[model samples]
Target: MSSSALDVQIKSLPNQPGVYQYFDSEEKILYVGKAKNIKKRVSSYFTKQHDYGKTKVLVKKIASIKHIVVNTETDALLLENNLIKKYQPRYNVLLKDDKSYPWICIKKERFPRVFSTRRVFKDGSEYFGPYTSMKTVKTLLELIKGLYQLRTCNYHLSEQKINSRKYKVCLEYHLGNCKGACEGLETEASYHKNIESIRDILKGNFKSSLQQFKTQMKNFAESMQFEDAQRIKEKIEVLENYQAKSTVVNPKISNVDVFSIVSDESYGYINFLQLAYGSIIRSHTLEIKKKLDETEEELLTLGVTEIRQRFNSQSKEVYLPIPLDLGENLKITIPKLGDKKHILDLSKRNAMYYRMDRLKQIKITDPDRHANRIMAQMKADLRLTEEPRHIECFDNSNIQGTNPVAACVVFKNGKPSKRDYRHFNIKTVEGPDDFASMEEVVYRRYKRLLDEEQNLPQLIIIDGGKGQLSSALKSLEVLNLRGKIAIIGIAKRLEELFYPDDPIPLYLDKKSETLKIIQQLRNEAHRFGIEHHRNRRSKGALQTELENIPGIGEQTIVELMKQFKSVKRISKATKTELTEVIGNSRAQKIINYYNKE
Candidate 1:
């Protein structure tokens, strides 16, 4: 379709809450999204300039537009989720259908048997969860078993089978683990009562169960049944201990969903925490690859909808680090302090840890992907127009104005290229003038690279404040390479980064990866420069001292150094030892020089 035809379809969209789908020229769905006003949202795509390349591409490929108008935003969100799942649009966040998660199933029978399963059926049975891990499912099952006497076998306990004596009690019954519902030893009413308590326990409501157990223990003690009372006491303790371990905040905060997000340039990680009676019962972190550089709010909204639907959660309230409009049916609370803030922080930490672990795994398994992510992150963090794949950092080292020198360190793909490291002695500058030394080295390094037709670094770093950065920039200007390469300076006092022609410095977070890499480069350059300076100083000191000696030529000093290693060692050497290494006359001259000192 032409631009006119596309504009006509966008103009015809209604002004209401709905979902919209974008289709490419080949009639394939490219994206699915929801909006409060369909016309305004659709038109903004055409009017605004998008920074992300993918969003621009998506806009250009829009051959057609389709939409479904809804009465409210909640309906729109639901419809959008369904449409995305149905079509699996390329530009939408990927929401996995977690069919592999474990669930606790209560079978639809006369006496229900509870067990964990990976599959769900539409047989009218109750399934409690689709937990994130098998360990959590197992722990829940064990807790229920320790507190209640429930059947674990698959035997059908129909009235006809029980009346005909078709089944016998299993070993579980003799072990005091089951109530023998198969053999009719446990009444149906009593068994259903235990089932009700188990259901409540699974819902993370332990109050009723604890009350009932305390009452039973009190009755057993009154009847002088010491063993039964002791068993009941043990069960109570077990339940209490489990609850204490699970609860993270005040028990008054119940049946709410907590969500927090951590994002980078390419993906967003959202962590969901399902709380019941102030205990965290469910946790899941979703990784969403960004197709259009989506913001945290957009990803969080979509993530909450998808996660809640997948887990079959009917939570009326939610806690978030940021406030969002998720329809009027759900109450969204942004926690500022107290227990709510603590839980939100916990969720945020979970998201951060998940992101860290995922990046570490990707670094080992797919290094290219990891490098791309770091480059993109650095580009954004430094506000560069392009990724700094090749970078060079320059540092000047001079102690008390004595052997002034500069070092250049190269980094390719955010790692040090040790083979590309170079050192320079400041020949044009007189004293420890850092600015002059920096200007001289920067000019020489790039002049040589340009002369030899070698590849130039995308970025240049100066290990000083604004003064050194300006000095480096002047070289770029003289070489007619100004504005062709990015240059910045790092101050050693506070790790502040100075950009060319910018007075205000960029202060990255102390723990940010970009800052760490910049610091690494600065430190490496400083160390390299200091090492070269120390070597030059020591060599210069040795030459000046020995060259001043009378009748001590270069060859004689070389012969003595070959044997004694240093001037101090040669001076300390015995006459016989010196004669063996060098000639006797030169050896005596070296000994006389040191003896006068």
Candidate 2:
């Protein structure tokens, strides 16, 4: 929090655009910000008589600061947003709800039925939503039903026909809304034709499809088909009205993931706008923890890298918040004027609004206490030359010599670096030997690190005691990586820690903030390792059983796996269900063979 410390930190920063963070002594982030010029933006905080009412009060508690320089202002904006979501800082505006949004689920039946749901399970179907507004999804569904004259009744058509009295037309039929299928006035071909029209509308081709419907209505009117023309006219009006209400943000660009970051002193918000074929698809908001004295550019860079690492795809062309320095090398663009500007402006406004809402919800006055304590403890206990900027942990998992897997999780300044998480399928190790698996994983991981000439972890924590520690040390020695990395082993005895080499494992007092943080990191690595192991084991078992079936080649097995996800599910499926997924002959063979017992 000293001016001298601030000056020292500023000397190391680049003059480029980026996002920055202010961290307390315990390494808890206090504020996040974005900057056009890292040096100027960060230095402004230390100047005397600056507009430092709230920031001045918060800055007094600051222990340290970190930054990430990006190629452009827009990239800084994105990075800032991503960081806010990752570390919900106390001073920034944040969105509270983390619930999954509702989506429209279409059951994979012979005749697919659409329904609105917030929950998505491993069921055989397709989901298309997470729509920002439920009203939009409902209106579209209603419009499709009106135009297509598809079945809206929940009762099964065949059951209704078989169990009920001789078929009688419903009210929709009388109103010309049913297509007269109940009265047998229309053939299956005519009904299916209407269904196809509905499908087109749902796919967002409303303009062209509506025009065709209008032409048909006119032709019917010219032919003196009064009732038919009236029906078609009504459907066309419905489509036009629906289109009129829907706001079009951009018509030129399709399938874009728009991002905007809003931050103040303590926290930030990253708003992700998903557009599909020039239409708004959905929006997601994430919160970030703020750093005290870091520049905006550094924060934004970190945010973008994290977002890109977590969510970017080859199919996406990222839009920028400001002009980038990467120039023509990257596909980032800052809109100067016109519709693109309008879109970016809208995104910025949304982010700002979210920030305001978040600021209002913050109740804490001084949020750096916990972070400072943890950092202090870590420094004292680890006997480090400097504070640990990046800590890496390793854990291995397997079940009785089957499907062994290892995971390496990275923590940069006391938080998980999801982008740096690595998983290894135990290849060099043959059995359930956790020690050997740990050794192989450790060797391969560090060997790659050496080959890539990357930074080494400040502290490496293994999940087991003496044996595991010995194995890791042996691997490091064999790979000529022994002296380059700092390593430790953490063994858990019920609720206690047993450290290797040290006769007494270091255990912080239960009330200590540092203990909680270290425990979180260790547990996360363990959870990650176990999850990876289970996934590999499950996939291996399924693939082995599936490959044994005759005529069920790898491709077919893959298809079946993609559809059903598990061998147990596939085994439980009926011939009819299997046929629907993989055709009749294969389904019959699978059903007969699997059920033969």
Candidate 3:
């Protein structure tokens, strides 16, 4: 289809909420999106200038549009998520997780066997979970095993087989792990009771099991069965201990799915915490690779739908850091404080930690990808037009108006380039005027780079507040480089970042990698500047001391320094040693001066 035909199709789209699919010339699905107003949203795709390259590519490849109108935004979101998953659109967020999570299955046969499996089949069996890890599955199964003596063997346990004595007890029955269900030693009613308790336990509701155990222990105690009572008490302790460890919030806040998202430029990590009876039963983090620079709400909405569907969750309420429309059937709660907020924060922390661990692993396994992610994150966080591949930071260093100097530290690909680091002595600016020194240093650094046609930095960080930033901007304007190069000022006290013509400073998350890089640059520049200033002060002191001597001159001191590496070595030198470098008269003058000191 031509652009004119595509436009006509978009124009024919309804104004109601719906899911829209974009198809390429080859009839392959390019993207899937949800919109409250189908026609307006599809039209905006052509009218607006997209910032992301993939979005622009997607728009260009869109040869035709197809949409399904829905009654509400929630329905649109659900429909869009399903279509994206079905078609696996190229420009839609990828929601596939290939890991086969473990699930605790209660077999559907007589005297059901409870065990962990990686696969789930529709055999009328009760499948508890697709847990995030095998360890969690093992732990839950162990707890259930300890609490109930359920059968582990797979036997038909038909009434005729048991009556005919066709099956016998196994090692599990002998070890007290099973109650000989195959031999009909355990009644169906008793076995089902234990299975019901296990079901409640898997759902994070241990009240019924605990109450039953307490009642059995009381009966055993009343019958003078102290050993049995002791065993029941131990089981109770174990159950309570596991419950305490799993419970993260108030017990009243139950049976809801909590989701929180932490996103970077390239990916979004949404953590889902399934809570039941105030305990976290399931925790999973879903990672979605962003294709069109989707917003947090969009990512969270899709992630919630996908994860809930994948886990077969029937949760009617969800707690999120931000409000979202997820159909009229699901209630969205944004917690502000107390236990609800704490759980929400916990979900966010899980997502954040998952993201950090992934980045760390990628850094070691794929350094290029790690660097790209950092660069992309920095570009987004700093709101730069391009990734800051090459950055320079300037810092002024002086002590009580002495030896005023500035240093410029270069960072390439988010790492310090030691060879490119430069230091400047404050020649044009006499006193310890930081702003003037910044202006002078900025002018000289870029002016020299321009003269030699060296590549300019993508960003310049001024290690001070607004005053230093304005000063650097003046130099950039003088060199006709203002607005061409991105520049920001970092205040030392608060680590606030100030941009040109923006009074309100931007405060990045203290733990953000971008802020860490900027802080690293600032600290490196400060250290570099201080080292240079200290050297200049020492050199000036040496000159001042030598000038005090009536006969000593700059040339004589220079010749003496040529023999002795430092003033301390010169002071310790013998007169004969000094005479070999300078003349006898100058050596005597140096010796006399040192002797007097």
| Candidate 2 runs further than 4 Å off | 1-99, 121-124, 155-177, 180-200, 291-315, 323-331, 360-597
Clash pairs (backbone) in predicted model 1: none
Worst 10 residues of 3 by lDDT: 90-99
> Which candidate tops TM-score?
1
Q: Write the per-residue lDDT of candidate 2 for residues 1-597, one digit (tens) a residue.
A: 666776789778888899889888788998787788888877776665534256787667678889999988757766777787789887654524334667776665434456778887668876665566788778777777677655444544453563454567678767655654544566666665655565555545566677889899989999999999998899888877776554356555655656677654344677766554455545555666553333455445554545443433232466768543432334776777886667777777788777656544442442343344345457656555445667888888786767788889998766789999999988876778888888899889988988999998877878887788889988889987675666777767632444435676666567444556567778988899888888887777876787778888878888898999878899999888899989999998898878884
Off by over 4 Å in 3: 14-18, 47-53, 68-79, 501-509, 542-566, 573-597
Model 1, 1-597: lDDT tens per residue?
Answer: 899999899999999999999999999999999999999999999999997899999998899999999999989888888888888899888777767889999888789888999899999999988889889899989988988899988887899999899999989999999988888899999988888998888888999999999999999999999999999999999999999999999988999999999999989999999999989989999998887889999999898888888888999999999888999989999999999999999999999999999999999999989889999999999999999999999999999999999999999998899999999999999988999999999999999999999999999989999999999988999999999999999999998999987889999999999999999999999899999999999879878988899998888877877887888887789878888877688778877878888
Best by lDDT: 1
- TM-score, every prediction: 0.94, 0.41, 0.88
Candidate 1 worst ten-residue window by lDDT? 92-101
| Model 1 spans with C-alpha error above 4 angstroms | 545-565, 573-597
All models: lDDT? 0.91, 0.69, 0.90
